[model samples]
Target: MIDGALAPLRILHLEDSDLDAELIEAELENLEHPVVIERVMTRDAFAAAAVADRYDLILADYVLPTFDGVSALGIARAQCPDIPFVFCSGTLGEDLAVEALKNGATDYITKQRLDRMTRTVVRALAEARARADKRAAEAALQALNQTLEARIAERTRELAEANAALQAQIVERERAEEALRLAQRLEAVGQLTSGVAHDFNNLLTVIAGNIEFLERAVLDERSKRRLAMMRGAAARGASLTAQLLAFSRRQRLDPSPVSLNTTVASMRDLLQSSIGGAVRIETMLQPDLWPARVDATQIELVILNLAINARDAMAVGGRLIIETANVAVAAPPTRPERPSPGEYVMISVSDTGTGMPPEVLARVFEPFFTTKEVGKGSGLGLAQVYGFVKQSGGGIRIDTVPGEGTSIKVYLPRDETEADGDDVKPEPVDCAVRHPPGSTPVLLVVDDDAEVREVTATRLVETGYDVREAGSGLQALAFLEADPCIDLIVIDFAMPGMNGAEAATEIRRRWPALPVLFVTGFADTGALAQAGVVGADGIVQKPFRDGELERKVARMLSARQAPGLRLVADRGRRS
Candidate 1:
């Protein structure tokens, strides 16, 4: 029902009699909502009017001059399917009206009982509105379903991406943990190797010194030749020990500000000749490269070792390219092993040769982890390079593809100072000093090793000094306290109970004017200085040549006699 007073209801009437249409309109006028009606008599007018205009209901006559009520109902059903259709006729029989109801008409009323017209119209309009509401509800539900499905799909994609990023982060964390473990293992091994080399160097020095004495005493050609062979074998042993020291980062270094380009350029001829005609050598030195503070000779050794490894890989010949550049690391590098953000001097060596596989590359920096045949390689080459670079406060990166090639990059921290020309050159000196004879300088030699103590005493005696020996720092201290005649003290840096530095500290307190020299295999000068033992003359490595020992001892003694002269030690000649 339209409440009888709302907006007008639009109605279309298909009736032949104008009076009959007015009667039907009057019947609807009593109902809710004002009625607006259009009368079309012929079937053509009814069809044309329904198509052109929208309406709320359709009232038609069962019988007409041009068309019947059934024809009008059919046209209204086709043109405006949702509008209510009703037949009103004076001669509409009950059976015909029932038949019309079954054919899509809402209701049919006889003119004799036209009072029911308003009730039928009200019921038809209500049903029409209910149908429209149902359709609208179904359409809104369909739209909601589509929106929910699209949102679900987008959320699923975002979750998948987050999962993938988490997986990548897990992998990187695992790799970093593994690298840390490898570093710890290498450090422990280096410490052990250094300890063994320290003792081995002392033994080798004894053997070499005795061999020299035998060579001078034996005059026969066969014996002299045999002694020379023994000396050569000892020298080779010394070289091997040196390699161990290098890999363990226990070898002495003379660090200075040096240009990477200049160092690489100077080694060009030597590298080419050593690698031979089979391999081609090239350089791409950056003109404005920054200087780095490092041991120039050791850096050259690192390059040479890498080049030699490259040459060996290229059995059929290949090209070796060395490049230097100044790099600014503003963020973490693409390679994880490189240093953190700062300026650096980068040296890259690339070779067009057989590259290493993943497994070999992983273990390449490990000492004695070689891929070569039984005796072809000692396997310390890359290890030495790794130690040298790390000890010089640098990082190394290696990139290789199985069949492509290999490129190794070394990044050393930048030194703003200019490069020194004599960075790699050893200090020139006359080590053969004539021993001055007056009162023989009473010297005290302290070492935990009995053989080292005996050998050192023998060398001092041969060099025109009265020598005394002690097996430990405690023994040396006891000896010095008992006899105040000792002119100088030669103590091993590392001892069992009390170290050389501690003994030196005690000696300095008791005898402030006494000069002391420290001997060790460790190359950590900063550590030694912290222990109150400083100066190159005051520190000497084990297995030193007789001339080196003599020169150092002579210099210290000369300084003692002339209190005015300052005692200075240059590591260049000490090595």
Candidate 2:
């Protein structure tokens, strides 16, 4: 499919002769595609059309009764710089054509050979379409990046306010229940932030997908570079959203049995180098340490973040100790929010350096509350640690003095299930499946946003799929009931009246075996379950990359053909 298959070719012609204007219109109609021509015989008509309407190409006669081609070209250039301008005159000389070409005209042609006008108009329209696509991609990327930045700023302010509230509670000797409720409120904010990030991801997915197509359609080095920048910005936005989800304890994770002692031992050399040789390092690894169920990558980050913080605390040289232990707690924890009574793998880190004061310690785990100078830290390290531990069914304790030192302990629940045996879990089937031989599948895309729905449909059509679109879930249901040949359904999660999940349920009731792929900005499992969504079924988040949705759609369709095919559930989170 062509890049601008749906975009119409709009032309603005400046010619005082009615016969010449009609000739130009006839020439335009001779081309394969439809063209809309607006003729202006006077400078006032041309000026009014230039401001009031948008055009793909401007064709002006070299010599007009009132204004020349140069004047019209100037006006078009100033009003719509990206639009193409060309000279179509009967009394044009070689020298005059060269001068006009020098003055931003696309191409100069004589009336005797009006046949050349066809090729010129085609080339100009192609370039104009390319520019329009680039501008639209840039605008979408800019809007997403700005949103990511604004959300980060807003989160920071909320953290600061929570800190102030905590300090006030300390002065008034408020009950512990109040603190618990405050924590719940913070959790609610995290949930809201996560949802917004999910939606942003969906948007990015659409933008990124179209960008990939645009990159292949264009060959210029500058256009490729600009698209690469837009891709980078989209990637950065994805990272920001993942970090927010991590802090909120809503990010999907894959946990396994891991030995705390061995994990720390493996990172000894790396941590030593990361913290520098100035601080002496010591490890007290307990023999036969119990295994804990956690995400090793996240655990490694927690340890590294603590080590980095310890190194920074000691301005000069100091001793840093990392120790592990296996403990069983018979009684309940001092804090009700801590982990339950059970066997746990305890990992502790201690440092001999200047410690945080009472006020600083109180707000240490709050997101974006950093003590380090500006540009030095993001203030998400400890917050991430806290969220990871809690989400992994673990607890964290902090003990510190004003100037002596600080010790932090992390307790992870022991994995004592029978499957703790030395056996590897089988990996899921690859979801990047290709279509079968000589198969042209049909796809139905449902979304409330018109731009997203149209772009998504256009992209799918480009990829060899018969694509149909609907503005809402009700419309999608109506289409599904009427057309029973659609092989797959791609629907948005959040919508007015009937939502993606509701639509999925209704479809399942009618078309029991049909495959459905949800495009959503929501990360809540309970809400998804209520909407009949599962990890087994494919899901593509908002603001996803160009290839992501296609791969997922193809995978879902393939999985439908062959049962017992599984997909990698988690999309994986970024810090």
Candidate 3:
């Protein structure tokens, strides 16, 4: 999608000559910037244009037979105070030019020196953008402050009410109850964020898919730049949503057995470069470290996050020590509040920096809770680490002293299964998609969202497949029964009735060999596993980039065959 912020610059030109307007358009167009210009000559026309349309810059002649640039500038200032207005005239005195500048004209350019037009227009527009950005930042900060204040006020009121219930029990029960409520509230927020992320991911998918087509269609440098900007923004949004999913513990994880020592040693250069020359990094790896079941990429991220946090805490030079060890957890009174009993692999990050205070420590793992000033940190770093550790069926502990330093220990469940290799990945199926011998591949798209369903089906159709849409799993089954031509099913995991997983389970019971591709947002892995969606091959995360959906579908279809032969390999009955 072309966000207004990144769209072509809209220009309002007040020029009497059609030829001059054309020249200006040609000049601006040749500057390699996307632009749209609307020419208005008469005073009334200028007035109407100023009021009717929003523009980034206004270009006007210094003097016309009937009206003047100053008058038009005044009108523009009154109508669009923030827009940049400049004068391009054939004749104007130095005094008049100074007067024009005093009267709010961004700049004046003589018609003879049209070469300066690009510089003037670019500068004016750049200033306008800077002002708009500053205002936006201020407004966002105000909104964030207001929100934080409101939440604090509400929490205080709730605590006050609890205090009133029993004066003596207030202290003890309040702490306990507050902890309970905090846990419940965080859980609830995680669920809500997960659902919202899902819907948002669906929208992003449609937007990104269309953008891909646009990227291919537009060949000009200017248009490509605009598309590039939009694509970059979309990628950033995807990254942020991924962080939210990680913090919410809904991120789809791919786990395998790997040595933590190897993961840590691999980051030697990255840690040094990221932490800078000021901080010294040391590693203490045990001779025998157990392999733990984990996502190697995520473990790398967790370590990076902790290192960055430690770097931030230490304004001056400090030492960072990363260590790995094997530990057996006992189910005794020792640290009974946590961790349970199990064999685990531990990765510890210790920093000789200013440690967090009690207040900051209390909410350190909470999402969006940060001690650093705004913009320095997202607060999701620790939250993501916490969620990833917990979701991996592991534990995390923080030891800190206010004036001393901090140590964060992450425990990953020890894997009994021997590794085929470090962080071994499943061998992929045949990835060459071919059409059925006698028929074009027919695909079924099941999604509760009409827009998402349409987008998915359209992409498949454009890819040269016969596509069918269903708003529900029941409807999908009905379609499957009506047409025996569906070679693949691309269905959303979260739906109103009979979700993708459930539907896939039912489909499997009826026909076990059919390829089912699960589309989802920050999804519940427990549900998918219970419903029997196979490994990463069967699932695609939401807000997928341009050709991601296509690639996933192609891979799934590559594993399929002609309808009759496919059926023969599975159950005999076809619904």
lDDT by residue (tens digit), candidate 2, 1-575: 12447566778888889898888888877677767788888888888888524887788898987788888888887877787888988899999999887888878779999988888777876776777789999999999999999999999999999999989877545545655764676687667767887898899899889989999998999999999999999888787677667777878878987766557756767998999999987666554455688898889988998999999899897999887778776766544235568778888899998998988976777777899999888887777787888889888778899799999888888876512554433234332243344558879998988888887888789989989877666556545433445678888888876678877776676555667888877755676677566784468887877698889887887777643233321111000
Instruction: Supply the global lDDT for candidate 2.
Output: 0.76
lDDT of 2 at 464: 92
Put down candidate 1 lDDT per residue, 207-311, tens digits, no spaces: 999998998799999999999999999898887788888878888988886766657755767998989999977666554456688888888988899999988
Name the regions of candidate 3 deviating beyond 4 angstroms: 1-179, 331-338, 418-575
Model 1, 337: alpha-carbon shift in Å? 5.3
Between candidates 1 and 2, the one scoring higher on TM-score is 1
lDDT of 2 at 136: 99
Off by over 4 Å in 1: 2-27, 35-128, 154-162, 329-338, 416-575
lDDT (CA) per prediction: 0.77, 0.76, 0.78
Worst ten in a row by lDDT for model 1: 566-575
Error of 3 at 461 (Å): 61
lDDT for each residue of candidate 3 in 359-395, tens digit (9 for 90 to 100): 8977787777888898888888988897788788888
Query: Which ten-residue region of model 2 has the weakest summed lDDT?
Result: 566-575
Better of 1 and 3 by lDDT: 3
Clashing pairs in 1: 4-32, 4-33
